[model samples]
Target: MLVSIELVPRSKEDLLRDITIVENILPQINVLNVPDLLRFDLRSYEAASFAYSEKKDFNVIPHIRAIDIAPDAPLPCVDRPEIKEVLVVAGDPPPTEQHEVYPNTSVDIIKRYQKEAPHLRVYAVFDPYRRSPKEELEELERKKEAGASGFFTQPIFDTNLLQLSMDWLRDETVFWGISPVLGEKSRRYWERVNNIVFPKEYDFSLEGNIHFAQRMLQLVKQQNDNAYLMPLRVDLGAYLTELQSFIVY
Candidate 1:
């Protein structure tokens, strides 16, 4: 199985520090994905530079939201030889709605990339958390025809997700996302930001939350070979230890 970690954008200095920390654990990870947030956040390209600078062997996938680019114009980052894969989405609008909104959806972006930048691998985002599996497959099939070859999912806490992955997505590249909330503060953050009230079975105390995440991973490792960790702003030290121990060496 391949483990991919999400690297959130931050100040250049902090980002550089994170690169050092990630390098120590890079041998254990297959890919580092850089995320682009709603606000005028640090660009993923800057983070990509740090990954490329390291004289190491690993994959770096930077996200580029459709809201940020024009389809006809040149995409500087897409032209780079080092970045072979990109996750394209119709990014969230700014909280203040201040920025100029680009009128491109991810489908439009995918169609454009398929024709203009045929060399780059475009991945679509999928969220099967609250929805039906059949509907997710229907949508993914459309994306596949449009040019998306792979997908990254929203946080998952159920085994039914694994069932969908194993049954419908067996041939396609899938990265199952898991986030372990450190405590109530972190849990509340998820609730407020994503409005996700964890099902009672998956929500209890912090330990229960970690248990739920572990069970999700154990289920995933059995059926799939790719997983993405998306613990937003939660410290990863203990979580990494748990993952290293759980993974079969």
Candidate 2:
């Protein structure tokens, strides 16, 4: 399986530091939700520079959030010519003092990218657990029609849920699954940072989460022969080693 890490770089220095860390761990790394609240700058020049630097040393894939695909937005080809593919997500809007920015839908961005950058393959993000099987399949079809070349799913803990969604969609497009590892404290931090509201009795821990990830990975490999594991927010080297032992890559 090809392993990759996602980084949210808040500044140029942060971007550089992320690149260095990524190079030491995975052979390829993707910058997720770029130009969004975390990165904030998605101009072609800036993206190209980051892409160039990342490509010079490591395999870096630049991401394009849905909000960045404005009708009048310029192409990134001018600056970073090496960026051949982009992960298009309905990015969160600018956060307010009290709340986080909700992402606009991704269909518009997929359409815009198809019209503007024909050579760049677009990837659309989907959360299977967030919707019913029918709804998930419907969204995937919509995105495919809008010119998305592939689909990436949110972090999933339940394999049965994933299988049901995949069975319903029956799509030929590439599907990337995310598995995030967060300790108890980190999970709480993420919830607060993203303003995620959960049940009052919910509990989040690294041990339980990693166990869930392993189970999901097992089922995914058992059901889909072509599925590749994509571990997020953790050490790639360690995850890869564990996956190598578990999955028949």
Candidate 3:
């Protein structure tokens, strides 16, 4: 099973510091994913290129918002030889409405990439909480038809939800997302903003989060699927150390 870790691109210095931290848990992580935050000056592909050039074996996948690119324009990574993969998302609206955004959906961008940047593998977003399983499955099929190579899902706090999503997407390449909800505020953000459904016995401590990550990883491995870790606001090294230690391979 492949394991991927998500990183935010704040600045060159901050991104490298995180990469150095990730280096401590080498061999356990197979890929690094950089998200394109609108507020951040450094683009996801730029950060990914930096990491790709710095690391020898590790793969880098950058997120690109579909709305940012013009419908007729080619994908951003066409000239970036270092970035081989990208995740297409129906990105959040810009902080200011004065900023323009394209009307293109993720599917539109995926097809665009397929035609223009065939060398780059495109991954689409999957949000289990946004819609019902059947609806989300249909959306995923549409993405597949648009030439998405794989999927990266939203962070799942419930195992049952994870299993259902896994069962539904059994034949496809899926990176099940897992993240830590450290405090009450973070938990509320997930519940109120993302609409995540947590288990009744969900524990909100670091130890609890580590234990949940372990279980999720073990189950993902058992199903022969990949796992994506989004250790938001947490200690990446220490979290991975405890989580990866529990995995057999």
Per-candidate count of clashing residue pairs (backbone under 3 Å): 0, 1, 0
Query: For candidate 1, what is the TM-score?
Result: 0.86
Q: Per-residue lDDT of 1-249 in model 3, one digit per residue for the tens?
A: 888889898998988888788777756665899999979889999988888777857788999999999766667999998788999999988998876898989988999889888999999999999988789889999999999989999999889888988888899999999999998999899988888888889999999999999999988999999988898988878887888665555
Checking candidate 3 for backbone clashes, the offending pairs are: none
Q: List the residue pairs that clash in candidate 1.
A: none
Name the candidate that leads on TM-score: 3
Q: How many backbone clashes does candidate 2 have?
A: 1
Residue 185, candidate 1: alpha-carbon lDDT? 81
The reply for model 1, stretches above 4 Å from the true place, is: 38-41, 182-197
Instruction: Give lDDT tens digits, candidate 2, residues 6-62.
Output: 545457676666556555554343433233344354443354467566556443445
* Per-residue lDDT of candidate 1, residues 114-147 (tens digit): 9878998888987764357678678788888989
What C-alpha lDDT do the candidate models reach, one value each? 0.72, 0.56, 0.88
* Model 2, C-alpha of 181: deviation from truth (Å): 5.4
- Candidate 1 local lDDT, residue 26: 46
Q: Which pairs clash in the backbone of model 2? A: 48-80
